[model samples]
Target: EGEWKVMLFTCSYSVGGVHGHLVDYMQPEAVSTLLGMTYGEYDKRYKSYFGDVIRKTFFDDVGFVHMEQTWTPAITEIFREKYGRNPALYYPALFYDIGPETGAARIAFYDIRSELMAEGYVRQVSEWSEARRMRSMGHPPENYSPNSVVAHGDILKYYRHVDIPLLDAILCFRRGLNGFKQVCSAADLGDKPVVGAELCGAYPEEMDSAMLYRTTLEAMARGVNFVVSHGMWYDTDPQTVRIPPLIAPENPLLGPALKGYSTSTGRSCMLLQGGRRIADIAVLWPINAIQAESYMFRDAESGLPIANWHPNDVVNYALSGMLTNDLHRDFTYIHPENLTDGKVSVEGDRLRLNNAENLQEYSVLVIPGGGYISAGALARIGEFYDNGGKVIALASLPS
Candidate 1:
């Protein structure tokens, strides 16, 4: 079974003066209105709401719950508690250039939002699942792109509590394939045994068995050990089917090969599961740089204020292609949060991620040209370099 938390696009709630939609660009007025309210009131209310829903679902014998599109707006109270400052003071900086402090304010704003979503919602659900001996998994929207700054703050932190770090691969085989590394890297850092991909939804109706197999192989090659084919439709009548290329037996073109394909994938997973990936390069996720550079501007076409485009947005995507296809070097993304939290450290001329299951040691660190970096991460990078580890800065250096 599946459940959506906080924001579901169509329906959502305001928690602590934070509107579920447009989280990244909330105005001062919206946040100021909640100042008179008691601290933690909205947080408690949200916890109650989540607890009630999960309790009822679990009572009905559902062993697993996939929390879909999990994200939260920046709660004013949470911002104050976590950052020790009133978020209303920095509202302008979050959306526009106010002064020299704009960049720093933007980074702090997004950072707290990321922490809130991970701790308040994701961690709560994960703990509940652990207690109940069930499992929790899901991926936020735009998990692959720079839009993740607006969608969920930071991808790695967003999956801090997920039992299986999952990524959504939709449309054609090639689209969004670059995102597999992000999810797989999260699983690797967290020492998660399984990495999942929701495969091949919204592909063309003519998509054949070969396309399915190819997509599956691509995902596997990127460290995905579990595959959840998009769906089996209750009714596959061509006239009524909502999303095409159904995986059920009703699809005459692909049904006959499903059993063999399933067996092949199973065999592949059997060999790959519980294995550690060896990558000599550690690519910094550059989330702080992305956050500092991102801001809302009015869209010329729609007249709506939207997150503006920036070159830093595609750095990871471009790097993924170059490293995987062109350079043919295996790499893993290291979140800056890990550095700040001391989960990553320098050891004997190598940067090491201290995961319980998959302890990764990197001889080189690649910073993908984002302008800003957290002080904690920069310190670690300095240590790595000073200790004789190779540090490669692409395009530009962090200020």
Candidate 2:
């Protein structure tokens, strides 16, 4: 029988978590890109590995991936050349904006509702109205888009610093489907085999398999075909199995469903085995529980609230472990007897991997910066660069 392939739901740096963690996804030439070396310098290092494959096939090893906020025509083209497949992109549902930067989105909406009216969309009208009001005041409400038509109702400005300008970006996408109709118009993404693909804090912690299963069933009936699930944030730290801060320990987030999916991950299909799946329906479950138990999510990362997103806060307060049920007919994720034995960790703090010596043996690492990584870590990352290691760092590297 042929092996069943699994898709890994990952955002380039979300997989890394920090600069040293960037070794989790690095290639030799990536090191040159870091130190500002010319492609020739990169090629010099590249030849050390497998000769011309560096110029020809290095990126092929990384396979299919989507940048959370950096999806562009050029990026799309790059993926096509390497994977021979279209790449999935992440578009936030918060607001829409597109044009030659004439600020068309701002003028398009008489308010948020008018755009919906223009698009003839009627689902969740009140929510749209609230977002409109917030946008007008230079403050937009929070929103999550699992699929085009289906959005969760966990709106709240957890960012503290409002995302009013995000409206422009969303407008660019939404109105494009209708000749720049209204900036606030959503993309013509009506039930396009949507996947909740990934979520941070859309579900409340009180939710369990019953709620997750029921929601999945309804969304699928509405047009969604699968559920990729948002987790299994394992790393080689071997000491910290961090989960997101929005899950509850006793909730079904730690149940059998996820474990089944994890086993699906270990299968030998080139895609699944490669660890690159854009989940169609991801339940952001248990990491929430781990956070609540430790109160890690409540603290801030360099002043920002740790559980920065409120719905995420609710999730962390609810989950207990990392076991998933079989949304598919296959394997599951089992709870780690020792948290260190697993890959996901959630002490709630961002940007701390103990010390510098911990960065060996990793091929690619991610450095997530809510704003910026610490100076000490930054220098350590420079060493990683000097050593010809690769990093998938954010905030630390220029995009």
Candidate 3:
């Protein structure tokens, strides 16, 4: 028997998938079923529904086994039943000799926001009993979360461009800015040109490894922590699930090139991750404005509601980017709700970011746009101004 370390670095089961068999995870029926089994008021017994479903899906459809089976020595009841005694072997212990084992849960930009509000989207037929109760109570209401809406054009954009950034503004960004030493960026978000940021790309058979290294380095002066080779093909000859351009042992130059790049970038990330970020500016995330725009508009061409970020892309993307990379001054995105919740505090001419142990004191609060700002947010801003903290409002003041 042997043991090995395993870490799931890339898992996107949260949003499902775009193409390939993984897309089955995104299907409405399957998603609805999974959502209900996990979050819906089915019973305490169904508490493990979400994990069990993931296990069943990956194991039954794909040849790959679940993480628990791979990492742990625990035997399942089925295995115990099949054999008279406890099964002596466990894979990957059964497969290869692994020395020390470690497991870390990794995620892309997605937070637990979607799961937190799962009940809002219970399938109508599935909720027939609940629907009856609502009807008896006078009127049933639709889910308020924007994810429930059907938009014309690409649905993936709704998640990629909108939900991710919104969560960043409201929750994740604060934690990231305050405490995280090294920020892990994925292909989509990491693609932004930042001084010490990483970039992800795939397909080595088609692309030269040298070019990949050079281009990535050229994008950022300090280079990247690591270039995530989007994927590696497991079996070259059998090619059963080949999604080329294959880049692993199969691609001659890729492995060595990446190794070299990693070696070159090693100390850079170490140094970058050590320092406390300095910021004199705080940007008030205009989430309310974006939400209002989403509710008010439908695209003339696609008949879909405009992409959630499209309405305020200027403030969210361009301005933020200008401050982040172009200006080279560190800034934090302030969620409006955080103001009402006392997460943001004012002290004489400075606004203090309170979510972290090392409170980030900022000299100026920059409020982007003048759309549907909440009264609480306005009051907080007013208090900041009253306390002599400088405030900058773009376009117009909140009405």
State TM-scores per candidate. Answer: 0.79, 0.22, 0.48
Query: What stretches of model 3 exceed 4 Å from their correct place?
Result: 1-199, 202-205, 210-228, 236-249, 296-309, 312-314
Candidate 1, residues 1-399: lDDT per residue as tens digits? Answer: 698433222325434442323322133333333321421354355545543454211111011011112224446677687778876777777546879888888888777667765664456556655654456777766665444565566778878888887787787777766667887888888888888777888888888899999989888878888878886777777767788878877888789999999999988887888957899899999777777866643122223223223454337777888898788788999998787786888896998889877888899888888788878788888888988999988888876
- Give per-residue lDDT, candidate 3, residue 51: 37
- What lDDT score belongs to each candidate, Candidate 1 first? 0.69, 0.25, 0.38
Clashing pairs in 3: 3-98
- Top candidate by lDDT: 1
Q: Which stretches of candidate 2 lie over 4 Å from their true place?
A: 1-196, 199-206, 235-253, 258-399
Q: TM-score of the candidate numbered 2?
A: 0.22
Better of 1 and 2 by lDDT: 1
lDDT string, candidate 3, 1-399, tens digits = 599666332223423322233322323465567546653564345435433442111001111111111111122333455444333332222223333310000000011111111222222222432332321000011111121211211111222211111111111112122111111121122122222222233233455676555544433332233333334445665254354444455566565676766676565545544223456787775545543332212322334332322343325445555565567665665666667877677778888766333356789988867455768788888988998889987765655
Clashing pairs in 1: none
RMSD of each: 10.1, 26.9, 21.5
Q: What is the C-alpha local distance difference test score of candidate 2?
A: 0.25
